[model samples]
Target: MSEKPVVRSSILPIPKSIGLVWLNIALALILAAIGLGVGFAQSGLAAQQVILYTVLMAATVFVLLNYVAVVFEARAEARAVASEEDQEAESSRLRQLWADNRVLAIAMATLLVLYLILTAAIPEFRSIKNLIGFLVLELILLFAFKISGYFAAGRSAFIGLIVLFALIVISAFSIEGFLSGPNIKAILLFAAFLGIASVGQTMVALLGGLDLSIPFVIGSSNIALLFLITLGVPSYVAFGFILVLGGIVGFLNGVMSYRLQGQALIVTLGTGFAVAGFTQIMTSIGSQFAGNVFGTVPGWLSNLAAMNGRFFGIPFPPTIFIWLAIAVILIVGLKTTTWGRNLYALGGNRRSARLIGISEFKYWVGCYVISGVFAALAGSLLLGWSGGAFIGVGDPYLFTTLAAVVIGGTSLLGGNGGYGFTVIGVLVLQVLTSFLLGIGLEYEWQQFIFGLLILPMVALYGRSPHIRATV
Candidate 1:
C-alpha cells in the first residue's frame, strides 16, 4: 500500500448560466406549444399550429439534450463535493451555487424526473397535446417561483399586481372569451361584493385583529333585511337597522376581545356564531326555513349590486362605483385622519401608543365597529343582487374576506397594511377564481390551490423580523 498513493479526482464544475439558458429555451418552446394546443384543441390544428408545433418538436429535442447535460452537471457537482480535499469549503461552495441557481436547478431536476416517469409509465403522456398542456402548467409554476422573491420585503401588494396581470394574460390567451366584455363585467361585479365585505377585515387587520364574524353578520343581515322588507318595514329603515346591528356585534367583539388581551380571532368567531344562531331562531318564526327570507328588493337597492344595473346611465353597476368610492375614501382617510394615525400607533405598539395618549380601546373598538357596518352593508347589497336572502349567502365571505385581506398584502401582525392593498387583493382573488372556473377546475381544486398559494405568501411575510423584535 505504501508503494502507491491513491489520488482522488474531482468532477469538472458546470456553469450555472448553462442551466438558465436551457430553462429559457424550454419556456419559449412550451409557450408556443401551449398557445397552439389550447387555441386549436377544439378545431383541427391550423397550418400555423402545425408549423409552430413542428418547431416545438425540434426545440423539445434540444431541451431533452439540455436536460441530459444538467444531469451530468449535477452528478459532477456531487462527485466533486465527495472527492474534495477540503470537504467543508467544497460543501459551502456547493450550497452557494445552489442558492444562486436554485430556480434553474429545481426546474431542471423536477422536469427531468417528471418527464422520465410520465414517458415511462404513461404512454399517452407523450402525446403532443398532453405534453403541451403539461408544459403550460410547468411554465406557470416556474414563473411563480421566479417571482416569489417579490413577496418578501413588504412588496406583496406590488407583486400581487404582477401576479394578477400575469393571470389575466394567461387566461386571456388560454381560455376562449376570457377577455370578453361580459366576463370582464362579471369579474368586476363579484369583486365589488368581496371588496366591500373586505373593508372591515382590512381595517381590523391594520390594527392587528381578525373578524371572523363578517360572514356570519353578512348572512344574518341578509336574512334580516329581506325579512324586514317582507314584514312591511321601509327598505331604508331596515337597511339602517341591519347596519346598526352589525355595529353592535362589532362593539361587543372589540370590547370583549380587548379585555381578553387580543383574542380577536376567537372572540369574533364566537360572536359570529352567536349572531348566526340568534338570527336563525328569529327568522324561523314564520318561515318554513330557518335562514331563508323571500321578498322584493327595492329597485334602487337592486341597482346597487346587480350586473344589469347601471350607474348614471352607464352599463356598469353602482356597486363597483360604491366600492371604488369607499376605497378612495378609506385610502385617503387612513392617511390624513387623526383616527387613522392613532389606530396605526395602537396597532404597532400598544404600550408606546398609550404613552402618546392614544387609547387602544377607542381605536380598537372603532375599527371593529367599522368592520361590522361594512359587513352588514355588504349583506344588504347582496340582497339586491340575489333577489332573495339565505343565511349561508355570506358564508363564502368568511374565507374570501380574509383571503382578500391577506392577498392584498396586509400584515396580520398589525400596523402595516391599508384598504389600498385590499382592493388589489380583491381583484386578484376574483380574477383567480374566475380563471380557475373557466379552466374547468372544481371548487375543491380551487380551494386546494388557494391554500397552496397562501403558504408561500405567509412564509414570505413570516421571514420578516417580528413586531416585538422591532420594538
Candidate 2:
C-alpha cells in the first residue's frame, strides 16, 4: 500500500495570523513591575519585603515554566517514534473535523462579501469614524481567530461581537441617536426576547435534535392561558397548566420518535403542525374574550414585559432579569451537574452512552421536556411583551431562536456547548440586526443578512455522519 497522507483540520485559511493574544497580559505585567519597582524603592522595610516577595513569586513562575519545557522536550525526543504515530492519528482526526465543518468556509467567504458590500454602502465609509471602527474590528478579529480551537465554544460569538462593536463605534459618531440610552435599551429588550427563546433551542440542539414545534407550542400555550382565564381558571393555575401542556407535547414527540426510530427533525415537524392546529382552535374558543379588541391578558403578565419600568433607577424590561436568571441556572447546571455531564455524553455518542448504562430513552425524553417547558415559559413572555399572539406570533422566533442557537456555538450535532456562550451569541446577533436596521435595510433585508450569517455557524459547528477513508 502507498503511504497515506494526513489531512489537517482548520476552519481558518491561515489560522495563526490573528493577533497578539498575550498582549494584554504582557502590558499588565510590565505595568505591574514598574509600579512595584517604584513603590518598593520608596517604601518602608515591611512594604518593601511584601513587594519583593510578590516579584519573587512572579519570577519563580517563569523559571518553573522554563524547566518544564526543557523536561518535556527531552521526554518528547525520547518518544519521537511513538509521537509520530500520535501526530498521524491526530492529523487524521483533524482532517475528519475539517470535512465535517467545510461549510464554515463557505460562510466565511459569504460574510466577507457582505462586509465589503456594506462597507461601500455605508454613508461613513470614508469618514474617520469608519476607518477607526474597521481598524478596531480587524484587531479583534485577529485575536479571536488566533485563539480559536478545540477549547472555545463561542467562535462565531466573538466574530459577531467584533462586527457589532465596529458598527457601534461607527454609528455613534455619525448617527444622531445611535448610542443613546433609548436605542441601546431597545436593542437589549429584543435581545432579551431572542435570548430567552434560544435557551430551548440550545437544549434541543445539545441533544443533536431540533424542535420545530416551538412556535406553535409557544403561541398555543399563551393563547391557551388566555382562554383558560376566560373560563374562570386562576391566572397562575392556567400558567402552570400551559407549561405542563407544552411538556406533554414534547413527551409525545420523544416517544413517537424513539419508538419509530424516526428522524427527530421530521417528528418535531409533525408535532409543530399539530400544535399549530391546536392554536387555531384555542383562538376560536377564546374569541369571546375580545369585546372590541382581541384579548385582555393579566395585569401581572403585562407588567413583567413592560419596558418602561425602572428597576433600581435603571430603566429596563423586567423580563430581562428572568432571562438572566434562566441563563445562570443553565450555565451552572451544564457546567457542574451529573445530569448535565450525561446529557453531553448522550448527545456525543448514544451508542457509547448506552454501553455505559445511560438510558437513551430517558435522557431523550428529559431533553425535550426541558425544551418544551422553556418554550411554554417564553410564550407567556411573548404574549406579555408583544401584547398577545395571533396565528403568527411565534413566527419571528422560529428563525431568531435558531440563529441565536447556532451563532451561540451550540453544536447542532450535539454534545459540546453551554448557555453563557449562547447568551453572548444572542447579544451579537441582536446587535447585528439592530445595526442593519439602523443602516436603513428593510425588514426582509435584515432577515436576509442574519439568515446569511446563521449558515456559517451551522455549517462549521455541525458534527454528524462520521467518515473515514482508505486507499
Among the numbered candidates, top lDDT falls to 1
Candidate no. 2 TM-score: 0.69
Candidate 1 Cα outliers beyond 4 Å, as residue runs = 1-42, 46-90, 96-154, 457-463, 466-468
- Per-residue lDDT of candidate 1, residues 1-471 (tens digit): 012222233343222566666665676677666545545543556777677665766566555555555565665656554644555665798899878656445554555565455445543334454455445645654565566666665566656676677668767765779999989999998999999999999988988889999999999999999888888999899989999999999999989999997688999999999999999999889668788987788988998889899999999889989998999999999989998888777778888999988888888898899999999999999999998899999989999898888878787888777888889889888887887687666677578656665554444322345455687
Q: List ranges where model 2 is wrong by over 4 Å.
A: 1-109, 115-139, 149-174, 285-293, 310-314, 456-471
Local distance difference test, candidate 2: 0.67
Cand. 1 TM to true fold: 0.79
User: In candidate 2, what are the lDDT values of residues 346-384, reduced to their tens digit?
Assistant: 778878789999998998888788778877887877777
Residue-level lDDT for 100 in candidate 1: 63
Assess the local accuracy of residue 463 in candidate 1 as a C-alpha lDDT between 0 and 100: 32
lDDT per model vs. reference? 0.78, 0.67
lDDT agreement of model 1 with the native:
0.78
